[model samples]
Target: MVQLYNNGAYLLNGTEIIEDNSEANAKLATKLGANVISKDEAATGTIAYGILEKHNTSGNMDKLKIKFDKLTSHDITFVGIIQTARASGLEKFPVPYVLTNCHNSLCAVGGTINEDDHMFGLTSAKKYGGIYVPPHQAVIHQYAREMLAGGGKMILGSDSHTRYGALGTMAMGEGGPELVKQLLSKTYDINMPKVVGVYLTGKPQKGVGPQDVALAIIGEVFANGYVNNKVMEFVGDGVANLSADFRIGIDVMTTETTCLSSIWKTDDTIKEFYEIHGRKEEYKELNPAHITYYDGMIYVDLSKIKPMIAMPFHPSNTYTIEELNANLMDILADCEKKALVSLGGAVDFKLRDKVRNGKLYVEQGIIAGCAGGGFENICEASDILNGASIGSDEFTLSVYPASTPIYMELVKNGCVAKLMGAGAIVKTAFCGPCFGAGDTPSHNAFSIRHSTRNFPNREGSKLQNGQISSVALMDARSIAATAANKGYLTAATDIDVEFTNPKYFFDQTIYENRVFDSKGVADSSVEIKFGPNIKDWPEMPGLTDNLLIKVVSEIHDPVTTTDELIPSGETSSYRSNPIGLAEFTLSRKDPEYVGKAKAVQAAEMARRENKSLQEALPEIDVIINKIKDNYSDVNNINTGIGSVIFAVKPGDGSAREQAASCQRVLGGWANIANEYATKRYRSNLINWGMLPFIIAKEELPFQNGDYLFIPEIKKAVEEKQSEMKAYVVGNSLKEFTLKLGELTDDERTIILKGCLINFYKG
Candidate 1:
């Protein structure tokens, strides 16, 4: 489906890929005579032009220096950001900031937690120069799509689906520490990246929706790592075939492909998107040259795209409706096997039970969030369900508009009436269902949704506690089709449905009349509000010359999702409170990571109290004495007891900061991973002052309980040293090397200061 050319290839006559390998020909002659086209000939030598630029951070990567524009976090995550910042020495909001409350709006879990986080957000907004959005006002991406995004602007957010390309913005979703860089006025440094061309050639088939296209592209690119860390620039003749809403749907889900960022060719469709959202001034024409060359190409024949579904466990496990129907039993049984690797025999998760009359039946269907809540998508779904009752069977249906304007448009167009007539409930713009706070199904329930993810716990199930549910991805049209069938999984293509949506009616009056916009200005002397449950950050220690850390948790899952780190649903309310929220860290992992990690942290506190190693713990002396007898060079070492963990892959869900900060509060010193699941998690680790280390998959030098001692660890970070030798024995001789990936300059100082909190202290 996609091909990348690593050699210096050129596009000749706009129809072929050729390497310039003729050595006998003159360099200039070979380059000029063939009507050659290269990336540099178009703009910036990248398929994505002004959307991205040089890193331009303040310091050297060798020194880990950085500087950033503004910082952003949401209520479900800000408490931890503030706590980490406070620990590292926060005074006032050093830069323009935004605190939005959307993830925890349901207030479903831990009574008083969600409301308390909201109060803390409002208070923090006042105390700092930041802006705060009250609960239910708007979903995070919708709010960003409106006021925060601008042409050629870069935004760093804590949510993994933080995309605003249709508005001409280049935004990245990372963990909280990355936001700390912006708050501390540090730059974001990254090596220049290569860009790929997503060349579209035809219009999508009738009854097919954006989610269908997104699922198609994700399936093709994800497993093979085709677009990982590369920018996807939409182009070609078919770019003009899709509407702005259609493009936005696909762009938002690109995060699932693990791409670094994305941009689309901007035209009237983009202008219409901004104009409908009341931000037309943010629009700019962004297009590649007629002869632009790409490092890679994805030739998408949109007409060939069809209704699709991503099986449980990942966004990439896809199959066409036709293929699925032909192999229902075999495909479903295969899904059960894959679930075993992830579910670990916790609960019997299956969809075959819903195969009524040999047609797969889903109990629920959802069309919501940044991916499916748009006016066009919902309006079309309403058209499909106009007078068809969904029936009061085991199957039910619900719809959520992405924002107030989208909701208002639906009401004005009679789409809401159409849906209501069909027995589908229409809700406001909230991300609750996407994260499992609302519309929870019974145990073993199978649902189809147009949301961003379907990770195991992402459906809001607590497998560790013996409760479980599952979700699958589908287009809005197909989800509606299944609902119209009274729960039997049905493909929309089987029915004839005509979409009736005119130009969208944008009602910006809601935001223009209510949203608080400071325009990047900071105001001091404001009295901040603090709820009783809101607690300050725990104390953190500065970097030591040599460090000893014990690995507390080891997970070998192919991909460790963020939902596993802190969880979503009811626990979301405590996101703004560090210590209170830490109580839930790894609650699903072993349900003992918090207390176990805290036990190790207490020893670090004792070490800072001017006590001898023997005085701190008798066991420590025994280990040290045994080490001294075997090796004579290492002695009298400053003992620092902090916990670290290892995972095959981690950080793959909502961009909540609490994931990394919770670990930091529990005394996490480092994370050793074979590879990080997403960019956000690693950034969170760096912001929390934790070392993001990498080691070979089979060469793990330390076990879960083994202590790893690294001499001159701080110096190694400062020196840009890739190979770090860590000893296993306290005083003995066994040692092996681990690696730390490339670090930006500001990153080193953040570690030395103990976290992003201290990075801003001075």
Candidate 2:
């Protein structure tokens, strides 16, 4: 169970927690006599503050400009990131960059595009002095953990799960534009984030795994936004109880809590992790000051955490497996009701049909990707299934090691053989399963996985095609226990099994022989390879004095994921080509979105060509005529036409820039939402030169396909206006207010110039 602090708390010597109540100062005085410190002074004692102070270059703690020691990206993202940097006058990488091909490793989806991306990464590494890891070698984060991570260092990745706090490294996962800035020697600008303490106590039970603990924590904090946009600093007695791998498993899932980054109190266990990976010198002991203050605290009793499951469509919809079985019908009914909201009644989603003899059955079990692919998780899974067989009757199991070195060690230690003997198919290092690229299930089938997310359509089910499947997240041990039951949902604790905890031996020979490391030496003579499908970004128009944008798609879903915005799995191959990838925008969520956006884009195309906007789209005349009724100065010359989307909450998952860039390429000028789910998503919109508009939660003034015009839009942004007036195009132009929220000066310039690319071009 997790307990949340209602008020700020102080940690005394990293063990005792003193709540910041009325008598909190008295308590601190009782312990420290006259040595008590001010709240602002004590806040600097956190491990996060220490690491950030060393990396911050702004000379001001309130506003941060961070320069990371290294950078990382995967295949589906690296191609676009390098292309953007190349366009922005990149000669050689300023910092060490690693391009790993793990997302699109399989070339089966889009012909030669996958391999072409790999080749491009290799050549870019050679041309720009970067590192490239070939396909089937290692995933991005795992490789970073093995090689790139250094204690007390900062790393920025283009993946959301970029967390190395357990290794005493403060890492952040952000959009590709952030990486491009790092490649160009630009600082990552942000306000100093608040640090939250994850105060741990006691020890986990035998059957409890890291994922269970993580899910329990996520379930408690995600909805309430307790740690949102804050750095999670782990402290207290529980820090020494968990192993390094256990801490890592819990750390990587911190992204789900919407925290900016995380850092833990590092000890000998973390030092030994670096030693095992042949980087003992990279290890550094990190701890908080004797007395520290946290804006918020999450006190987790590890012993009380049971085996939990995150039900379909979200990582926060959690329930204990025992409770789920006891209340099967009610939970299944509740899931079906939530599915109606997530799926929009696109397909008939029913979990009741999966019940047989009062037990739920699943079609597949996957222990793959960064969350479950760790050495200890896989080894324990194999131990649980040592003598048990995963029967081959409408049920299958698959395992993927996070890196080739892990695979080699698993093979050497007989874990892979034991898994294979139990009818489990073990594969190489790939992030496909975690996304939607691999192990797509049949229609309406249920899958149990240990991957990062279980969002809708992330299991490769196309809602447009009337193919829908659901996934439930569990720990690797529980998934293996379910597989042993031949897909019957079973918790690992229900089965009496002794785990043969094996000590891992990391083999780095695979990476030494296969990976291409540029060693920070650039060659100007090298020619970068380009595939036919890979293309440069299209020209974008700057902000106009007056804006006319049509609401192309309106989504009322409580939260919209990036997967629904641009989709993954099949469309990942087209990410290198901006215009081509734009065609798939909102393809699954709204099939007519591309055509609607394209229709609105035609008027902008005509405006740029100095042609008649009325001829391009006949409806523009009516919208312009209605707008001219109130403001006679609004004309075609000063007005720009584009499309926008309104959602309740948008950009929930994924750090892929395509979520916003695809909209930009399709002539999207703005996004109207009640609130943004993540900071990375809002940053993507600003980086792509799109307006991130905020509207109230009341009834809408306009529906989809209605034109809303904003006068002096560019001037409003230049003036840093908090709210701008907009008129829905109707008989008299009804008025409404749209907020721009908070924008940095650089962000305002980026919006004025069009995008990051355009700002750099200017």
- How many clashes (backbone N, Cα, C below 3 Å) per candidate? 24, 0
- Stretches > 4 Å off in candidate 2: none
Compose the digit string of candidate 2's lDDT tens values, residues 1-762.
899999889998888899989989899999999899999999999999999999999999999999999999999999899999989999999899999999999887778998999999999999999999999999888999999998899999999999999999999999999999899888889998999999989999887889999999999999998998899999989889999989989999999888999999999999999999999999999888999999999999998999999999899999999999999999999999999999999999999999999999999999998899999999989988887899969899999999999999999999999999999999999999888999999999999999899998888889998999989999999999998898999999988888888888988888889999989999889999999999999998899999999999999998999999999988999999999999999998899999999999999999989899888998899888888888888876889999999999998889999999999999999999999999999999999999999999999999998999999999999999999999998888889999999998989999999999988887
| TM, every model | 0.92, 0.99
> What do the candidate models score in CA lDDT, each in turn?
0.75, 0.93
**Across residues 1-762, which tens digit of lDDT does each residue of candidate 1 receive?**
233344343433333334435641354346567753443664354435444442344333222233434456677667766655555555667666778777777776667767887777776676666788777767888778766776666677777888876666677787766665566555566665566667777898888888998889999888667777777777667778998888888899999988877877678877877776677887787766545556667767788998999989889989988789889989999999999877878778787776777888887889988898877789888988988989988788999998887788778879999999999999987887788788888789998998998888777788887888889999899988888878877789888787786668777777767666555454567655667777777766777777767788888888888888888877777666677788898887657787778777766766777557566544566655655564445444454568888899888766676788889888899989998876667877887789998888786767787777777788898898987888786445478878988776777887877877666775
Worst 10 residues of 2 by lDDT: 628-637
Q: Which predicted model would earn the best TM-score?
A: 2
RMSD of each: 3.3, 0.9
